[model samples]
Target: MSRSQRPIVAFLYDFDKTLCTTDMEDYAFIPSLGMTPAEFWPEANGFGRENRMDGILAYMYTMIRESEKRGLPFTRADLVEKGREIVLFPGVQDWFGRINAFGETQGVQVEHYVISSGLREIIEGSAISGAFKEIYASEFYYDAAGRPVWPKLTVNFTAKTQFVYRINKGVLDVSNDRDLNASMPDDSKRVPFTNMIYIGDGLSDVPCMKMMRAYGGQAIAVYQESNRSGVEDLLAKGRVDFIFPADYSEGTELDRTAKNILRRMAISDALAEENQEQLRAIGRDELPNQARLF
Candidate 1:
């Protein structure tokens, strides 16, 4: 098949732990509160437990509340600026382009997406943000003065599943488009489940990993070398299609797995198309009535 005729592979990644070493907020925001991650996280969790607030919302609220107490600006720009300092795992900067180019060689289109609970503004400001086709993540609301006032969207584990549907339907807006989300036929969706590849880490990604795998998509559970036990557990539980080191460096396990998956997906797509064409040819030659349907 020609390059233009190749199928598109959707590479969906969970950002916090899968792509980066730590949560974006903990990198700068939590420390800026003059508290350790241990100290700040427990307070956030306490608020969630007491008020029944969503954990993500509680964290965002804590960020704003603490910033005010410290006389620091809680502006969206401030958060984004802090995001710029958040470091990525090895080879992340070149991973996207490398994978995209590799996909071309395999006769596939590679599109990257971020399905994360991290701050959208922060991710947008990160060095590797431009590689993604869409960023489905938490975001904050701003006041008239452009200062962040409250959490606008608090993406959680289950909420992450909605992004898979959004990617399928090509819907970017989180609001005001109910029918497309509710009524689109599965075949009419832009990216089929079989062409999706999800990369994630830890329990926070269980919902997404399970959903993608259940729907014929592939899910990879990634972990640091020290977390081999956790990676093994995910594989044993059959929560992912594969497991590998979090490293994205070229020639690493992750890089090899990803390239192989893309190649296989392309082959599968080509075989399906070939089978369809054969069926059409058979219909044209032997069944006049069925030929019309083709």
Candidate 2:
């Protein structure tokens, strides 16, 4: 189907804590290197401090450095293998289908996306990878030997918001920044900001959360018991529209809220479409004297 034809509602997610309990790397890859999270992070952070490198790049570099020292093959395939072992939070496995079916009932197409700073290979290896229309995340470039050698892309907090615009413009290709930056009328856009829903964890999500508020989109913050205080502060400050537990189980608060948001967006879109049709249907004879559409 053409991009303009479908009334699309996008659910953009932050993968790590929002979709799963902990960071994806912490789940399997770090342990594979025989260093605890505590030992590994400080070393990675120290390397960043010493080199003045970006934190995301520092971590990506650390992944390659540690893998080589351990004599482990650091290919895209290797990270994906580690991804398979990563555990997900409650009911995440079934969440997408349930949400998609709910969207169908609302007469809108629900498109899922992952906009993360995590490794793309790891995310690609994830069990839930198939759920997303696109995964915008950090990725490594392969050498001639097809081994991951350098960071091809690193999507930090600020970088993530660009993908949101890409989705809005229907310019899915990451290389196409020209069209994304081009000024298009609100009505010409593929997905209106009001039709987008961003789901993220905590601090790092602030940029996109604020973006949603500035635009017409909605942002939802999900948290665990340990991070409930942080999420509450976000709510108190009005950085996000709502906060819910990361639970995606059937009929849970998160699921229910998502459905309601979808319902509202669908109704809003349908009303807008009806108004547009009526305006287009108005004849030259009916313009000034008599009102045909009431």
Candidate 3:
């Protein structure tokens, strides 16, 4: 089938902890400032609490303040360079190609997206950055000299859902709020919620995970040993449909489950297409018999 004729399945991901082993900053940014993860996070979080600032903004500010104090490079280029230090989880480097090939065999178009609270610049510089159609994340507004001046975008847990809608409507432009907020029929959407799969980590992912459950989409939480209990709590609370180890290797549980979801969504798309065709053939506005749809 042609690209437009094929059903589209979107795989949405959280960058930190989900794909990478830990927070992206922990890999290189924090250490470059002569601070450990232990020292930085508490300070950042504490700054937010004390100033009633948004946590993401607080961290961005802290990164700026600390780096400047240490006479370190705090330019956008500097941040992107830090991305090179990020260590991905098992098989993540090959996961996209494998999943995309499987989607082709099933006659569906697969797309990847990063909906993250991490720095967009950092994610853009990662090894697998090219795999995604779009990376929606917190970002810094840089000056003419390439120094970060202010927060251009800040994606907290709740803000992540906006990217989901953007993907659904094929409105990838971040500046186009008019089209994003405008009414459009569900049938006219580029990708339905049923064709989306969201992969995230723990509590910070709850809003997006719950959105998946409430809609027809699927929400999966991947955990490391350190965060297993947290993800388990999410599962128990019915916020996530599945919890797996953060392994994306071929034949791994995450890989198999992702392929299965793709297959199921593809079948559902085919059935929906057939139903529409039948309705058109019968000159009916809707199906004559609701039971005719399986």
Deviation in angstroms for 166 in model 3?
Answer: 1.0
Task: Quote the positional error of residue 74 for candidate 2 in Å.
Answer: 1.2
Which ten contiguous residues of candidate 1 have the minimum total lDDT?
Answer: 285-294
**Best-to-worst TM-score order:** 3, 2, 1
TM-score attained by model 1: 0.91
Candidate 3 is scored at a TM of 0.96
lDDT of 1 by residue, 120-199 (tens): 99998899989998898999989988898767888898989988888877776788468554787554567878889999
Tens digits of lDDT, candidate 2, 97-191: 99999998988999999999998889888899999999999999998877987788899989888988999999999888889889986667787
Query: Where is the poorest 10-residue window by lDDT in model 2?
Result: 285-294
Question: In model 2, which runs have C-alpha deviations exceeding 4 angstroms?
Answer: 1-4, 283-294
Per-model tally of clashing residue pairs = 0, 0, 0
Q: After superposition, how far is residue 9 of candidate 3 from its true place, in Å?
A: 0.3
Error of 1 at 207 (Å): 0.8
| Cα-based lDDT at residue 188, candidate 2 | 72
TM-score each candidate: 0.91, 0.93, 0.96
